[model samples]
Target: MGVFTKFGVRLLLALVLLCSCSIGYESDIDYSLMPVKQGDKWGYINAKGEYIINPQFDGANVFTDNGLARVWVGDKCGFINKKCEYVIAPQYSSATDFFEGKAWTVKPKGAPVLIDTKGRSCFTLKNVRTVYNYSGGLAVVVDDNEMFRAINTAGETVFELSGPAFVTNFVDGLAAVQNMDRLFGYVDKNGKAVINSQFYGADFFLNGKAIVRADDMYGVVNKEGKYVINPQFAEMQQDYNKFLIKIGEQYGWCDERGKIIINPQFENAFPFFGANLAAIKMGEQWGYVNKEGKITVNPQFQFALPFIGKVAWVKSADKWGLIDEDGKFVVNPQFNDVLCSYRLFIPVRNYVVSEYFDVEGIISWINMMLDGNKVDGMTVTQTTISGFRKKYNLGEKGVSVEKKYSRDMSYEIYANGTFYENVSDGWWGTTTKQLPNARLDYVTIQLKLKDNENTRPLYDAVINALGGNNGKRGSGQYVKVKASPGIVTIYVSDKQIKDILNDNLGWSNY
Candidate 1:
């Protein structure tokens, strides 16, 4: 029983037999036992919507991580699991999803191949021709007549990227491709071009900037294709890390050195500048401003978001909560419908960015505890555990990660502890409270100092700009600040505090 407890008892017996044909299903945001019915033929329902797998399928799919699912039926596709079982065998009309285990189908128009969830196609490609999805291990073909290339299921190629004409999907390590005159460019999976190809239109690089359209307007570059800020703007967006461009449409934020420093009058705007805060929208309403643009989360939400870390996510009377990146409300809007779900399982501390500021620094340690505290000396404890996995990434603590840094130091503690102690200087863990005047104190440290050798490598330039594979947790890697075989530490039952709470949780970004 425990395939999610027989999938929560066949999803409580398929939502008590599809609560009357799943009538319009909308418990409010998070819609998907899926079974929307009517259109594109999708299928599968049960969170009381019943049907379990019925939708008939002409196209559409989901379920994997072993819970198979390829779907399609008539023209092929295959896979399905979670006791809906077919295990793989639907054949192929085209398919997708399986990730690290492989998946890609295609037959009707033919070109894709790479199979494995047991439908076999192996890695064909009939000369490539069209396919996307698959990252880091590479995948993004398109040759035999269409022309794009990016192989790696052993077919090798890793970078071909023909004339662009359309590409996108790479995100961050960059991938916008397009040409034949539609302009725009960005490659870099070895197809090289980093920022080359030129930009007539482009977007997606965020933090380090990128958003170009140039001469016709829109500006900012930095991912090395250089341009610094110029273009001019009419519209642009990078989100979260900032860069909300736009000019004729009225908006501002320049500082990668082209100057604007966030002024253009904003009818809508976003972009970063030494950071003081920002989220403007003006007239009809939208709030959050500072850096002089003024406003600051007062526009009153019907929808809002653009803050991360300090918090943001508005909407009001209709319900949706959280406000802080300075707008304050903390958690006010009241839940009627909200889902910000960001938990790479939370973990950020392990500074190795050397230049010697005494080897590590970015400390804010301010615990008085309680009112909701949670920050155990962590080098990692990963938690989002609220109301038992509240379904954001389908919860169950989904997305807990394990990457141990080589650079990039960020830790912001808030304590509530349960258990964790993995000593290794960088992992003594933190946050495990229950003290109403009891006794349980903690300390944590993360150091960044480089010149002892590698020096400010910026996470080794983010692992060579995401071709990834930084792998280095070894060679005299020292942090020796707090975590040690410590000194006086003892624990007795609850399976040694549930094996130190499964070695301090997972998923982290900071």
Candidate 2:
């Protein structure tokens, strides 16, 4: 027999035996299985409140679409089938609900890995600074270098992207991305810029339509970047085939082609569910609205959730109850909480950001250093300054130079300071002390630019101030300033010899 079939038989037999010996019984939310608390422990009970499984677990989650639920034993978590058999052992520190026959989990002090139904490890990803669950056969991850990438089931990189400044995730075949200009656009699986970056914000496409923002207004746009709905509504919502639009503070319903099916009248609204019915609020109470904007279920309850299989959970005067499509109470208001557990098997989307890094802070620090003047840490001498001046053609009259500090990938800056032979005089004749000779003080500074070409202007300005590097005289005493790929060294000490450096970047004293 299949695993679920065998477990079902065992569960039925246990329920029958328990019901025969129990004193009283009550039905659960869906009348399938109920949760009971006994002596501080929780377990599953039948529709009649009879024990299906004894209260042995510390906590338990609702069963998922894969017919398995997560249960906690003391401090550890494990998955159990309908018959209460361990499918995946409780070894991971934390885990998400299973998706596409696999689940993402984290080991103690280890990287995140994917595990199959048999608890077999697929592969462990490295440098995964942050990761999300799997969805559409891929997951989004940010590496240690702060680069965003998408990985498939085998942990292979499918594509590397620049950003998702506002909202982005693959839904159909396109994923939203934010360009360098902070505008939103769509990209295909191959990382090609499919749509031009123009919208202020956007969402994943559903039914060949996506919600987009333009001029601080929300509207629906097609895959071809054409707006089916005009950019006018303050809010928009999609439910199956209907569109919910809100103008000002009042809510209304419209079709996909920007046609208003219902006038803006209700105070609030929600997406439509079973039988084309939507839950809406009239004043302070909630009710159901149909596609024609007709009120079918009267507004009576304080709050009402969407229907499932013709039944829904409702609230009245701080009490909870269950109601049918005709608004008749199936379960009277009594309990403090009510749950529609029968239809709780919703799939979790994998394209989400769990942990985000502070990109702005790092950029700010780099900008600060570009504007700083005071230099600290390692120092240079006078003789070394002369060598730099001669090497880079600082002209006949030497000038004071400044070197900024910066770090590499490892966050460490390796500086080759100037050194010279030192001679010392003592009472016992004369001796030489091993020490640097020149007083050339060069401060290393790191400037992070979005593009390397941006340094060209600064380089030209510095070289001009130093009277040109090719033995050509320009102006200023301190000459021979040069800049290369990822580096800049200037030989100027006048401090007032015309601060030629641009104010584009902020510098700090190291």
Candidate 3:
């Protein structure tokens, strides 16, 4: 997904608040000097929740690294430092966080302007209808024409476009934008349309993919504007990457291509987390499924959640216990309430097991190593032989290898070996070699390429010639590269991903 498409959603939710004082704990709480409310006044507290600055101000904001915090005196706002002395006396009606040595402030009787630490106006815009403080060296400014444009810190226009468009700060090369038609899309920093405003709604790109909504339906799409999962789902869980989808009243699982990996037979479903297994509900019972949609644990619990490490929280007779993937109890059902906290579960009594944290730390350390060198300095080369027996000159029967090349990562297109129609009727685990110091995660996808016209025969022949050792042959497809450890799926044509998969590279076309 592109950045702008996701920004459109946030921009819509921020319009009214931008015109007024920002609300909510994240906007107001100064974590450095935690703001606490007492009756009608606000005070600053330390991490221990003890008052550091007595309740006096009507409102307060987090302290900046420069040692100044925003405080509301009656109806006006000003900057106060830790010594309880006014850095900038309360005079402005509205103010924002300081960035790059300046902050945006709006006077009681004047428009907003960039102010220096000394509370003096440093710069102002002539016809600024709405403006955001500089971020990533650029701020979004709306002009009198209702058009949005990106302006540098010096107030020079970087790019301008005709609107009624809502623009968001660019991150990771793109920002979400909405055009006059009220559709969402993405734009690059140069203000060029990378993805046209078309979707009804969208989200920021993560792991090279994004969730998009169209015609009141949800689905996942790739950066190239192709629907990896078609827009047929009614709802998606918080973790759409796991492909937990809602269809009508039932929930199920799908692959990146929108194919139903698991039938919509569950009453409810939750997205997969650290492990591929997901908590699913059927009637009053809960269980889990691997990514292939096969039941790893039967529907036997009163409630269950996705596995965090090797264990998950499962409820039986209203009591929660920790169970491993094999459905054996690590912690018997005894807790009143047990919720997931990464690798540990928080019991009802305000305590956690120290043993769980030790395991979590080890997992975290291993993950750090895998992320650094998992794919570093790796190479995959596919060799093509003309045919079987011709090279051997023994008149034996076998398919010939055609051509070979080092696999390229820049392109999403490739060739793959296929399965025989009968041999395709099973599920398999897809795992990569354990990188040094890192644990490998696996996801299961259905083996369906044998039904496709372009891949079936070629893959069938390749598998047969290789004597059915998919792992050995597939190793030639992907050389590892350094990146964050965890799967980032990219969907290509059936032929392309299959080619990658035939060589045992972990990719999904579903």
> Which stretches in model 2 have alpha-carbon errors above 4 Å?
1-62, 71-77, 164-166, 333-510
For candidate 2, write residues 1-510 as lDDT tens digits: 111111101110111111111111111112344444456676766433455777777766655546676677876677777688899877665676566677777655456777786778898764565666665677777766557788888999988887643244465677777777878888877777788889877766666787777976778888999988888887775544657788877888778787789888888766553245666789999998777899989999888776545555577988655577788876665434432331231122332122222233443443343222322212233335445455445544344333322222112221224334545565646564433234454333333333344345444544443345323232222323445543344433313323335332222222
Q: Which candidate ranks first by lDDT, i.e. highest?
A: 2
lDDT for each residue of candidate 1 in 65-171, tens digit (9 for 90 to 100): 34565566677767767555677777666566665577666655344667676666676655434566564467666543456676677877766655744445554
CA-lDDT, candidates in order: 0.45, 0.56, 0.52
Q: How close is every model to the real structure, measured as TM-score?
A: 0.26, 0.59, 0.43
TM-score (C-alpha, index-matched) for candidate 3: 0.43
Q: What is the lDDT of residue 335 in candidate 3?
A: 42
TM-score: model 2 vs. ground truth: 0.59
